[model samples]
Every structure is written in structure tokens, then in C-alpha cells.
Target: MAAKRDKRGLSQYRNEYLAAIAATFSLLATVAAAGWSSPAIPALKQDDSPVPITANQGSWIVSILSIGSLFGPIITGLAVDRYGPKRTLLLSVIPLAIGWVIIVFASNVHIIYAARFLHGISYGTAYSVTPIYLGEISSNAIRGSTGVLITVMAKFAFLLEYSIGPYVDFRSLAWISLTFPVIFFILFFWMPESPYYLLAHNRDKEALSTLRWLRRSDESSEQIEKEFTQMKALVQKTQHDESSLNNLFARSNRKSLGIILLLSCGMQLTGINAILGYAQTIFSKLEMELNAAELSIILASVQLIAVFIPTFFVDRAGRRPLLLLSTGGSLFALIACSVYFTFDAFDYPTETLSWVPFVSTLGFIVSFALGLATVPFAILSEIFPKSIKANANAVFAMVTSLVVFVVVKLFQVISDSAGTYVSFWIFSGCTACTGVLIHFFIPETRGKSFEEIQEIMTVESSSKEKTKCLPLLC
Candidate 1:
């Protein structure tokens, strides 16, 4: 009986993990939509390409996703009201699937751009709702690890695009990308909606069912009942529409929103999207002996490795320290890249240091993956109150997409006007300033429960609410 009970416990854990992973397929689909341009750009720019685009046009193609994504999160957030997180996430796959199929037969650049934007809507929804779903379902003990899966899956998708995209025809690649979402919807069909969502809707029994399904069999029934009761009480206590713009600055949640938004802005300013979208353009500008496509693959591989580091450390080391480390390291790496470009721009005899730019870029990606790329997404779902959580995510996702649009467009314009050197200097400045801001403003969220995080935020908000000017930020 003891052995049978132990086996049952293991089976329960496996089932929970499988369900969580299935939900995360939405993330994989989001990334596949985002990363298509990385490899496709090079393929399109090839001499015998079917649709030849200028560098500026290529920038537009990559940035167009931002256009559609600006509206995606809010839509998904609203859909969560009627459909719940699982259905909202399931609905996200339809757009992605449709977009990929459009790409498969796209002959015109405009068609590709429209298809990208259409699909990008799902990317926005995935980032917004996926984190919330994962946060609600995940145990605090493993929240950091599970939350980081969004970033991990995204990087994995980026790598997949780079690896297979370069070698395959456009239609073939599109068909391949379409397959993941189909698989995702099939596997994710059985995963329950977020219990928190069920409880908020007053479906207590279903919430309890989901909670039990997500918990280990070895967990005491009393403990499970206690959790269910707490979820019910909290939902009843705090029930209200928290989506108003005024509530965005409400004394309680303002600080959490402020910090996460800054971090989100910083995430965009760090040039990750620019680097990924224009991997070929950036590599081609370098004085490397290898092909741009090969260099892009190398960078993607390094990025995939970099993205995995935070999963192990995020819960253990805490959020602020890693953000400090990542931003500080990225600051220096961006500066180093600036140095390389500056030297190359000046026509200096720098033949011996051709490797510096690639190495520095690789370093930036490593540091960025360690924290900046992963933490804000994790922190946002943790820090924000459940009342306004969906809208805050919507606004944040919208702003991120907007910032990414400006950054990508500016990258091409700046690289065309002054050079890559100036662009790196600007990005490094953003990193340096963001590092300082994080040090004084960002809170430590490791090992804290939702209630604990809220308590900290409430106290901090009340204390700091009096000051009209933020000392650290100002």
C-alpha cells in the first residue's frame, strides 16, 4: 500500500507538470510567430529570392507584428472573462494557426506583413494570459521555474526557426510552423482552466477539482481544502473591476505597475528584438569571415543556452540581484559592441579583432537571458493584484510592442544614418540607466507568496504614496 501510494503521488506530479507544459505551448506558438523573420529575412534577401525587399522594407516586415499585437492582449484579457484562461489560450492558437497558413502561400511582401501582424495578435495574448495562467496554476515553491518556461520556450522557438528556416523553402517552413499550434491545441484540450479564474467566477467545485488535479496525491485533503477555501475568500473579498486607467495608478498597485513597466521598457530598450529581427543585417555589418546565416545560427544557439540559466537561479537567488547582474553585464557588453563598431567605423587597422563584436553580442545575450529577458514577465504576474492583472498585462504588452516597433524601426534608420556604433551607444545608455533604477526601485519577490507580495506592495505604496517625486527615479 505504501509503494502504491508513492507511485500514485509520482503520477499526480507528472500529470500536473504535463498540464502546465501543455499550457506553455501557447508560448511556443507565440515565439514561432515572432522568430520567423530572423531566418526568413536572410532567405528573402538571397539573390534568387522570389520577393526581394530593401533593408528598410525588411525592417517594416519584422516590425509589423507590433502593429497587430498592440491590440491583442486587451482582447485576450477581456475574453478571459467569458471564456477563462484555458479557452482564451485555446482561442489564441486559432489566430496563430491561421497566420502560419497564410505565410505558407504568401507571395507578396504585403501579404506576409499582414499575415505576420494577424499572427502577432496571438503573441500578445500569449504573453499576457500565459503568464497569468501559469502563475495561478503554479505552486509558489516552483513558480520561478515554471514561469521561466515562457522565456525558455520562446528562445527554443527562436532556435528552431533559425535552424530549420534557413534550409527550407518558404512554404515548407510555414507548414512546419503551422504544425506546432495544431499539436498544442490537441494536447492542451484536456488541461483545466485556471482554478483562480473558476473561483473568481464562483465555480467553487470546479476550482476545487482543478486544484486537486494540479496538486500531488500525497498532499493532505485538509491542505487542499484549505487552499480552496483561501482562493474563495480572496476572490470574494477583492472582487471588482480593476481595469480602469485610474486604477493603474491606484495607491496600492501603482508601484508594482511602475516598476514592471520600467522593466518592460528596459527589456525593449536592450535591443533583443532588434538583434533577433535583424540578425542577418547586424551580422552582415560585422567584419566576420562566416556567412551571415551561419553567424545567426551561432547567435541563436548561444541565446538558447542563455535563456535556460535563469530557470535554475530565479527562485534561489531572487529577482533584483539577477536583474542587477543582467543589466550591469549587458551595459558593459553593449559598450563593448559599440567600441568594436566605433573602431571598425573609423577605418582603424582592426583586422586582428574581428571576433570582438560577435563575442560582445553573445555576452549581451547571455547576461540578458540570465534575468532581463525572463524576470519582468515573471514579476508582473506576481506583483500585480488579481483585480487589475489582465488589463495591466494588456497595457504592458501593448507598450512593449509599441516600444519594440520604434526600436526596430530606429535601428534600421540609425544604422543607415550614423552607423551601428551609435545605436549600441544609445542601447547601452538605456541599460546603464535601467540598472541604476532597478537597484533603488525594484523589490525582491523571491520565496514570497501572493499575499506576502501584496502586503509588501501595500506597505511600500502607502509609505511612498506621499512623495510627489520619486527620489531614486528622479
Candidate 2:
């Protein structure tokens, strides 16, 4: 009887996080989409490549995918709000699969451009939908884990490209990349729509069923009903709330918006895009002994290993602490890289110190992959009310897309004109300043309920009630 009861408990839908897992497969696919070029660029430059491309043309090809994604958030935001997360996610798969097919048959840069833009659309939809769906489906206990798992899958995708892309033909890589989305569609088809979305649409019966399915074993029907009622009430309340771009200009919303933009911009400003785009050139310039491909694979492997560190700490250590650590370490690493480049520029006898670039990059990746990469996202979801999230996310996505383009395009221009050290110095300063920004502006969200977090963000404490200055968090 005890064994039977345990078996029943284990079989409850709430006990399983299969839906979240399936949803993340789409994220996995997006990572593959983002990572595809890292290996393919070299292949395209080779004389034997099916379609040879120049560096100037290649920059557009690389950055244009981001350009496609620039419009994705608004489109994806509307789709999720209207059609719901599951169906919206399903929409993402079609474009990704089609993009791969286009890539497989590409004889020129134009076809590859078309394919990458399609992939960017898929990526944008996943970014908009997956976190929202995952947050809705998860128990509070599992939310941090799910977020960390996302980081893991993203790094895994990069590793997948590094590990496999070099050895395979471009057509073969397209075929392999194509399989991820097909697999995602198959796995996610059985998953239900987010219960919150169902309730907002007045599908109360469906929401209740999903709620019941998501909360089982120790949770009674009464408990499920109560939770469902609360969700319904929140959804209804938020429905009447304004989410205009004008709302983003309000004092409270501005603070939130500021944090969002800083996180988004800081993500790019820390120089990860530049590093990934020119890892070979950067390493080669430093006179590293290892082959470019070998160094890249090693660095990618290190990043894959390091990104998992957040999953263990996000809930326990809190968000701000990790962000501080990540940014602080990044500052130190960036400074180290800058010093190495400074030394190299003057033709210093640095044979013994050729490892500095490699070491600093590894440090930056490990630091970045941990709290800096995932915590902003986890906290971003928690900080906003359901009412403003859609608009806020669209803005966040646009800012992210715009910054990636500027920084990536500028990285090359800056390196050629001034020197790589100038960029690294700028990155070091940004990381240091972002760490300070997190200290003053960001809140610690761990151990707080969503309602509590909202209260922390919007409600000024009595100690400051008479003060005229509006603070981010009291």
C-alpha cells in the first residue's frame, strides 16, 4: 500500500517537469541557430566552400540575423497574447525547420541570409514565449532550475557547433541543425498551454484542469481551486491594466525599464559577441600556440561546463550576489586581456605570457556564463507585473537586438582603428559600472513571493514616505 501510494504520487503530472523540458528544446534549437555561423564562417572563407564570401559581406550576414530578430519580439509578443504560448511556440518550429532546409540548398550568400533571417524569427518567438510558458507551468521550487537549464541548453548549443561544425560539410551541418526543431515540435506537441493564458482567455474549465494537473499529490483539489482563483483574479486585474509604451515612461516603470536596459546592454557590452565572432583572430594575434579551432573548442567546452554553476546557486545565493560576482570577475578578466594586448602592441618579449588572452577569455566566459547570463532573465520575469510584461519584453528584445548590432559592428571598427585593448578597457569599465548599478538599483528576489517582489519594487517604505525622490527599491 505504501509502495502503491508512492507510485501514484510519482505519476502525478505535477511531479513531472516534462512540459518545461519539451519547451526548452525550442531554446536548444535557437542556440543551434545562433551558433551555426561560428563554424560556418571559416568554411565559407575556404576555397573549397560551396559559396565563397568576403569579410565585409560576412559582417552583414552575421548581423542581419539580429536585424531580423529586432522585429521578432513585437510580432512574437502579439502572437503569444492572441494565440497562447503553446501554439505560438508551434509557429516557431515551422520557420526554423524551413530555414534549415533553405540553408541546405543554398548556393549563395542571399539564400543563407534568407535562412538566417528565418531562424532569427524562430529565435525571437522562443525568447518571447518560452520563459513566459516555463514560469507559468513551474512550481516556485522549480523556477530557478528551469532558468538555469535554459542557460545550460544555450551553452550546449554553442558547444554543439564547436564540437561538430568544423568536421562536417556546410550541407551536413544544415541537416543536423534542422533536426533540433523537428525534435522540438514532436516533444512539445503533447504539452498543454500555460494555465494563466487559458484563464485570461476565459477558458476557466481548461485552466482548472491544467492547474489540477500541475499541482498534485500533497495538493488537494481545494488547494488547486484556490490557486486557480487567485490566478484568474490576477489575470483579470491585469487585463484592465495599461501596458502602453507611455507606461514605460512612468516613474516606477522607468526604474524597471532602466534595469532592463542595463541588463540587456551590459550583456552585449561585456564583449561576448566580439569574442565569439573573432575568437580565432584574437587568439592568433596574441601568438597563442594552439590552433584557432582547438582553442575555440576548448573555450566553448569551458563555457559549457561553467554555465551549469548558476543552477546550483540561483535560488540559494540570490540574484544580486551572483550578478556582483559575475560582473566583478568580468571586470578583472577584461582588464587582464587589455593589459595583454597593450603588452603585445609594443612587441614586448611576452613568450612566457602568451597564455594571458586564453586565460582571460576563459575567465570572462566562466564568469559570464554563471550569474551574469541567467540571473538578469530570471529576475526580469519576477520584477514585472503580468500587465506590463508583454510591452516590456518587446522593448527589452528591441534594445537587445540593437545593442548586439552596434557592439559587433563596432568591435571590428574599433579593433582596426585604435586597438583591441581599447575595446577591452571599455568593456572592463562597463562591467565594473554595471556591478555598481546592480548594487544600488537591483533587488534580491530569492525567497520572496511574486506579490512580495512586486511590493518591494513599487511600494515605498514608510521611512521614505515623506521623501520626494522616487527610489527604485525601498
Candidate 3:
């Protein structure tokens, strides 16, 4: 009986796990669009190139997606509040499919540009709304695990692009990618609307029913009702308080926004987007025996594997330690890459040191995947009050898109003018500054309920005690 009970307890989360997978599944295509340049750019620049592109055109192709993404969050923020995550996400698929169709038939650079912009819109909408949806649907007991799925799926998508794009022609690759969004829509259409959204709209009965379906199996009526009551009360309180743009500056919300922006900027400024977007081009500079495509696949695989570490341990080991450790490790890797580039820049013999850039990049990916990639995103869903959460995500997504655009657009120019060594050194300095900010400002939210996390944000910083290490970090 004891063993049977334990098995039943584990089975209760089956629907939650399935819904999270289906919702995030379309990320495979949108994210693949981001990294598609790694392989496609090289092909486009070839003498036999189907649709010839100059280096400047290639950079635009990569960066324009970010600019297009700026509109996505704005739409999602407005629509999610009025409509609901399920419907909003389903509607997002329209732009995504249209983008791919354009790409498949694209004959000119301008056509590809328009397609990428549409892809960016879909990417932004999915990212902006998915985290909020997952947070609302999941029980606090498993929220951390569910939240990390966003990054996990993203890394897997990057791997898919790196592995597949190299072997296929551009149009063929686009055709292959188009299938993912369809798969996501088919799987996710049947999934339930978020219970929190229902509660907020005063549809208490529907909210309760959805919660029961999500929590299926031997869960007692009283337990489900108790949970439903708590959710309703929290939603009611937040509705009464009612967040607005003006109140977004209230002490707690301002701090949360600051922390999110800092992490977002840090994640981009550290050059992850630039590196991934131009992985093949960056590796080509080394003149290695192995091709750039193989190296990119390896790097993406490392990132995919490293992301799983935080997925398992984030709720258990906590967020702060992993973040600090990831930052420290990334700093060390950036310094290593910078040193290699510096030697190469000075015309030193680097043939024997050919392995350095590849290895350092792998190290950076591993460290980045451990925390920077996953933690800040998870924190985005946790930190804000429910009233302001959608607005906050819009702000976060828009700012992040802007920062990524700047970094990716300039990386090629910076590398050409100042050399790769200069870019890596700048990244290291940014990483160091971000580490300092994170240490002092970012809070640990592991295992906490949304209410508890909000309470933590409300307290004055001066009033709380300092510790030698954040909880579990020591």
C-alpha cells in the first residue's frame, strides 16, 4: 500500500509535465530561426550561393529578428490579460507558420528579412507568455522544475539547428523547421487554460475544474478545494491592489525590474547570442583541422546537457549558488578565450593552441547553461505580483530583445575592427560587473510560494540580515 501510494503521488504530475512539453515544443522552430544563420550565412556567401548575400546583409538577417521581437511582447501583454495564455499561444502560431512559408519560397534577401521578422514575433510571444502560463498552472511544489523547461527546450532547439542546418540547403531546412509549430499546435490545443486566468476573470467554477484536471488522480475534493480557495484569494487580493504603470515603480516592482534587466543585459552582453549566431564564422577564424559545423554541434550539445543540471537541482540546491557558480565559471572561460585571441592578434604562433577557442567556448556554454540561461527566466515568473506580472514580462521580453539585437548586430563589426580579443575582454568586464550586482541584489526564491516570494520582495533591504552565503550556497 505504501509503495502504491508513492507511485500514485508521482503520477499526479503527468498532465502538468505533458502540458509543459507541448506548450514549449514550438520553441524548436522559433529558436532554430535564431541560430539558423550559423550554417545558412556561410552557404549564402558562397560563389554558388542560391540567394547571394553580402556580409552586411547576413548580419541584418540575424539581428532583424530581435527588432521584430520587440512588437511580440507588447501584443502578448495586451492579449494575454484579455484573452488567456492558451488562446494567445495558439494565435502566435499563425505568424510563425507564415514566417516559415515565406522562408521556404524566399528568393531575395528582403523576403528573408520579412520572414525572419515574423519568426521573431512568434518567438517573442511564445517566450513572453509561456513562463507566465507555466507558473500559473503548476503547483508550487514543482514550479521550479516546470519553469526550467523553457531553457531546456531552447537549448535542444539550438542543438537541432546546429546539427541539421549544416547538411541541408536553406529552403530544405526551412521546410523541415516548419513542421515543428504544427506539431506543437496539434499537441497543445487540447491542454487546459490556466486556472489563475479563470479565477482572475471571475470564472471560479471553470478555474476549479481546470485545477482538478491538472492535478488528476486520487487527489481528494477537500485538498483540491483548499488549493483552489487559496488561488482565488491571492488573485482577489492582487485584483483589489490593482497594479498600473505608475505603481510599477513602487519599491518592490522597481527592484524586481532592475534585477531582471540586469540579468537580461548581462546574459546578452556576455556575447552568447553573438557567439551562437555566428558560431561557424567565429570557429572559422581558428583555421582548425575540423570544420566549424562539427564544432558548433559539439558546443550546442554541451549547452543542452548542461541545462539539465539546473533542471534537476534548481529547486533542491537553490538559485543563488548556481548563478554565482555559473558566472564565475563563465568569467574564467571568457578570460581563456580572450587570452587565445590576444595571442593570435599579436601574430604569435597559435597553431598548437588551436584547441583553445573551441574548448573555451564549450566551457562558456556549460557555465552559462548552468544558471545564467535558466535562473533569470525562472525568476521572471516568480518575482512580480500577479497584477503586474503580464506587464512585467512584456517589459522584460522587450528589453531583452533590444539588448540581444545590439550585441548580435555589433559582434561582426567589432570583431572585424578591434579583433575578437577585444570583444572577449569587453564581455569579461560585463560579466564581472553583473556578478557584483547579482551577489548584492538578486534574491533566492527556491521552494517558495508566489505569496512568500512577494513578501520577500516587500521587506526593506536594510532591515534583512546579511549572511556569509545565501541559503544553500555555503
Per-candidate TM-scores read 0.94, 0.91, 0.95
What is the lDDT for 206 in model 3?
87
**Candidate 3: where is the Cα deviation over 4 Å?**
1-9, 217-219, 459-474
Expressed as tens digits, the lDDT of each residue in 112-189 for candidate 3 is: 999999989988888888888888888777787788888888888889889999999999988888887888899889
Model 2 spans > 4 angstroms off: 1-16, 218-222, 286-289, 459-474
Cand. 3 Cα-lDDT = 0.86
For lDDT, the strongest prediction is 3
Model 1, runs deviating above 4 Å: 1-13, 218-220, 240-245, 459-474
TM-score of candidate 2 on Cα atoms, chains taken together: 0.91
Model 2 per-residue lDDT tens digits across residues 1-474: 999996765466443367877888888888687777777887898888899998766666667677777767877667777888899888877888899999899989999999888887777777767777777777665577666666777788888877788889989998998889888889889988888889888898888887777766334577676677778888887788776667766655666777788788888889887787666657766556677777888988999899888887898888888988999888888999999888777777778897888999999999998788888777766667777776677777788888877877777778888988888888888888888877777778886756677676674445654263334322
Query: Which predicted model would earn the best TM-score?
Result: 3
Q: After TM-score superposition, what is the CA distance of residue 309 in candidate 1 from its true location, in Å?
A: 1.6
Clashes of 3: 0
lDDT of each: 0.83, 0.78, 0.86
Candidate structures ordered by TM-score, highest first: 3, 1, 2
